[model samples]
Target: MLNYWIGMAAICAFAMAGVLAAGRRGMDIIALLFMGVITAVGGGTLRDLLLGVPVFWMIDFNYVWVASAASLAAFALARHLRDETVWAAILYLDAFGIALFGVQSIDKALAHGFAAPVAIVMATITGIGGGLIRDVLAQRENLLSSREIYATTIITGGMLYTFLLAQGGASHGASLCGVAFTFAFRGLAIHFGWQMPKWLTLRH
Candidate 1:
């Protein structure tokens, strides 16, 4: 139950980021709402479908309600917010939501009998899937870029989390550590403009 609530809160946070992003572009409430729902449930819906499980929002309508409410609320209250504010929200909220959703999705996959590597992959997809969809639909820069190192951080943390979870004791604690690792890694990247080394970059 605690994890479920955490997941929903994370979803709402990312949804608000999406709404704020759309709102900045002069999108009306309806469009913002649409983007919010896509950002919130898009990842999890993909995860569940691939895992052959029931879709999450369809199972519990609260997810949709939370997303819609958050979108509307953010739209109403973001009038005074500047462009920098939305980017700030995107940086922090996206990192936090990625951590929460990644860990939760890993747990779900592990519970469903997936192997550690598979669970890690599942969580990686869940963590970044929505961002991928949103960036595409909004015609924004691709987030899964070698230069961004954004999705790379998620993948690294997912693998670390899966490794720790497989070590036997206190999986919950391990999960939190994983989230912290991802958040800190991303924060550092943002603060430093770190990216893959020159040697690792795709040559022109």
Candidate 2:
């Protein structure tokens, strides 16, 4: 139940962030809606498909409507904001959405009897798959292609969540800690322009 609501919240954040990204490209409202819906559901869709489960939005239909509504609302409000503000909001919203989706996906996988490694991988897909698609559609540089500590934070948090659960920590406490650490880590990276260590990145 809590996980369900957390998924919905992630959908809302991702949808709005998608709309802003598409709108920045001067896309039409229809295009904006398409991007929003895709970004909101893309990650979970991939995770479910890989997990051999029914796609969540298909099961709940409410997810689609919520993403659509949030996208349109964001589109309407974004027109009044500056580009700098829009980008900042997108980063923060994306960070928040990633934090929730990362832990939620891990929890889902664990519940499905997957091992820690598989659950961590699924969590990564759920945390960034949408943003990856959105960036491609928006013609923006994908975060994974950069040296930023983006996906690293998601993976780190997923590992922590799995470790805590394995150690018999309370699920609720583990989830909160995972989400908090992911969000704060990503938030700090965004604020401080932190980059991955040179050895951890690639060079042409």
Candidate 3:
């Protein structure tokens, strides 16, 4: 299915994020690859399990292979990424993963007879689940602290996607619109250092 390929793309994007972050922290090849695979497939794994469906990577090992290949590429290109003068690149990678995952996850859920509300919840889970795993294992910044509008944008775009699909729009157009909205919102947030005001700040 096209959703499978979309999921694969999201996996690779997240894997790149994990690999880049690991490289910044000076992780060895083995450690980087492991974390990268974990970050790539982590969200989909949890989504499948929670949905009571067969875990995707277990169904076909192609997911693992794809993840590994992406990680290896990132490892090879570490030097170039290391010279980046800004963190925006990593944030954009994360935004890409979230957007693609958000759309595909909701689409999968709808195909499985799940209603829109459930699909929305699953979209959120699939969007942020992998990055949460990566952050915990790699000790990266805690995104759940509301540091920016990351998950918020994913939620908004995902819900809009579901609404459009439910209204009988063309699948490809709707998915693209959803992905673009989420990515643009998140990319801008990263570019402008957008965050909640002091009254809403939870970080010290």
Give stretches of model 1 more than 4 Å off.
22-26, 83-90
TM-score, ranked from best to worst: 2, 1, 3
Q: Sorted on lDDT, highest at the top, how do the candidates line up?
A: 2, 3, 1
Candidate number of the best lDDT: 2
Q: Which stretches of candidate 2 lie over 4 Å from their true place?
A: 1-6, 24-26, 83-90
Report the C-alpha lDDT of model 3 over 1-204, residue by residue, as the tens digit.
875676677677778777876555557888889888987888788888888899878999998999899899889877765566533565577788788888878878888989888888888887777768877888778568655677788889988888888799999999999999999998888888888677776557
Better of 1 and 3 by TM-score: 1
Worst 10 residues of 2 by lDDT: 79-88
In candidate 2, how many Å is residue 78 off? 2.1
Least accurate stretch of 10 residues (summed lDDT) in model 3?
Answer: 81-90
Per-residue lDDT of model 2, residues 1-204, tens digit only: 876776677688788877876666557888888889988998889999999998988999999999999888888878654377666766787788799889888988888998999999998998778878988988888878878798899999998988999899999999999999999999999999999989866668
The TM-score obtained by model 3 is: 0.83
Residue 183, candidate 3: how far off, in angstroms?
1.8
Task: For model 3, state the Cα shift of residue 137 in Å.
Answer: 1.8
Inter-residue clash pairs, candidate 1: none
1 against 3, candidate with superior lDDT? 3
lDDT of 1 by residue, 141-196 (tens): 65666477777777889888887866865887898888999988987887788887
